[model samples]
Target: MASAAATSVMGSVIGKLAAMLTEKYKLAKDVERGIRFLQEELRSMDAVLQMLAEKDDDQIDPRAKDWRSKDGGIAEEIRELKNLVSEQSERGKRYYDINQCLTASAQPVLLDPRAPALFQEASDLVGIDAPREEIIRLLKCEEKQHKVVSIYGIGGQGKTTLAMEVYHKITEAFDCRAFVSVSQTPDMKRLLRDILSQISKSDFDQSQMLETVEQLIRTVKECLKDKRIITTTRKKAVANKCCTGIAAQMYEAKPLSDEDSQRLFFTRLFFSGDDCHPDLRKVSDDILKKCCGLPLAIISIAGLLANRSKTVEVWSNVLTSISAAVEKDSPIDKMKRILLLSYFDLPHHLKSCLLYLSVFPEDYSIDCRQLILLWVAEGLIPGQDRESMEQLGRSYLNELINRSLVQPTKVGADGTTVKQCRVHDVILEFIVSKAVEDKLCYHMEW
Candidate 1:
């Protein structure tokens, strides 16, 4: 009996030992898996830390610190970790949304079906109050049968607005229509790509410049073979006009008419929707004469007047400042110096590009594609070490347009492409004078 009892005890003890060994092995595996998961999570956190460091340098507040500070129990800690992930995801989404909004807003014109027209007859186009018959006559004279008629002028002188007005008026007569703003320095390849992309409504490899250009020209020729096209530029080159099959007729868009100037001045001075001040009108007429009908000058003077007390004395003071500036040299020269104040405010890279524009001839309508290519060639745009040169160039162009230093003359029908650009004659002349002053260009005597 004693022997049998001892055997049973030994069996029980062996079974217990086996169970303990299995349990210990299972625990070890669970611990190993947990360690691996924690290691992966730590690596993810390290990546987030690196991103946070970059954001900190940019002056953005880091949210990781807040997450680290949250207190939780064992189960709560796991939940909090999940919440942290969700929070980071939300933050990334917000950042993307903000970036997109900024990009959309920074563009000169964002084309949307719901967006308002470029010109609000009363609010946008200054000096457009002339008799409808006279205005239509001028536009009709600008019309061409088989060629593209480009109206060139200084920036902010209503070139695009005028073109928009004409486009809205005459688009019905053509089979197809396109409006493009060529704001960047002229590049044949980029221009072709833009034309093709807009026409086809598809993305393309812009790096394939030659192929893109050929494709664009072929597409444009095919599509607009019978359509009347209007393009604009700020670079004085006959080459751009000849690229497409259409013959190009150039129109030097003069400044606003004197009557239009007077209207613009008064509108700016007494913008409170009140009755007109005849005295202010008289003063504004004098200011208009000083403006020499340049819409940009008129607008600038008007902007100055709008910020001050609406009194003849204030207008007189503004006129005196302008007159003093004018007495220094030609109105165009004075305008350049005045406009330089705005240029001085640009970032360094943009300043270089703006100055580089002086290489082109006076009253030249610039092709955006060619301009960007030239910038890339000049090393004005940084390469992949930063943003790609093309992106930087485009950003520079956008900045100039936003500052009203460069104006869009033609926007492609697709609404995203800028076909041509024209600096205001006043601004162009200013650029030329600056170039001469800096000895960047020489005037050769024949």
Candidate 2:
């Protein structure tokens, strides 16, 4: 009987202790005593149950069973403890508004999808408004020319995004417009039919789709007399085909400046350029620096850091992970896709040349002549004696530049020859990753 009473008391004490632990409730000396008592009583009751379980069935009959192990009891101690616990729970429930508790307790807030994002703030953060406006202005010009403009940049540098912005801004002025991806190895008939149908707002049947390439080209020429269409591609070779009459004017999408890079790093993370947490400032800055102002890199890394606690130790580990990723070819998933597309598009010879160049440290400018000599020495330059090895190497460099994979650092006065070139840091990381994946090279840490 005494032991059963103790179990009831312990149950009540545990309930009260749980209430006290809630921040909204007060913890008094009596509450502490109740918790301690509850723990001790639980230990004793556990031993009792264990003993009962082990004892012979004859020794542990219904009469020997206590109230805890029995069906029911209304003894004063049991009844009183139950009442106390019920009353305490009712009081706690009155004070605990779930919504209020959640709002007050959460740290490092999350975005609510119900609210619309500030897109102008984004355009401002990434500093794309000027270029976007310029593209729009050029597209809307009243010149008699075809006015086809091709926007170019390394992968993940927001070429498509900037072009989309311009496309939207000026599409209404054209007779009809459609934006479509002309992926590598597009079927010319289908490709031209899609462009013609979209620009003229006509849907072609299967029979119409069988029209000759010359007929499709004529349709494009006729529709584009005053109307305009925009297409994006990874290579200038592809862009030239999109233009039927004159070559398209090329607008290069430059990487963000340092100031814009910082703003973009913070904007995507916190949705505001301001409001960086104090503890995260240094680590956030470090992460942004590694991004090399590439939109995809900055945005992907920011998404990762935002979910994590803003502690130096945690962020430092992420920094180390990014460094290891560069060595192991395991960059963030978004960056991997962008870079892999560019790397795969290269010809076999260019692929070897690009991967070999990855051996240079990030951001090191390669003199065209010297890089050509190195390629020639390694027998990487492709030829059947059609051109000298050095000339072939420079031709490879020029081709890569036109494809926007290799950025020319120093151009001759005529802008025809690239004297020096350098890979963007993001591309360098990707090339290193490819090299590691293919077992072509492995990085060593000092």
- Please, what is the whole-model Cα lDDT of each candidate in the order they appear? 0.56, 0.63
Query: TM-score winner among the candidates?
Result: 2
Worst 10 residues of 2 by lDDT: 109-118
Question: Per the 3 Å backbone cut-off, how many clashing residue pairs does candidate 1 have?
Answer: 32
Model 1 stretches astray by more than 4 angstroms: 1-119, 122-124, 129-145, 154-156, 186-188, 200-215, 234-248, 272-282, 338-446
TM-score of each: 0.45, 0.46
Name the lDDT of candidate 2. Answer: 0.63
The best candidate by lDDT is 2
lDDT of 1 by residue, 14-36 (tens): 33323333422223346546545
lDDT per residue as tens, model 2, 357-392: 877865567898888888877778743342455676
- In model 1, how large is the Cα lDDT of residue 302? 54
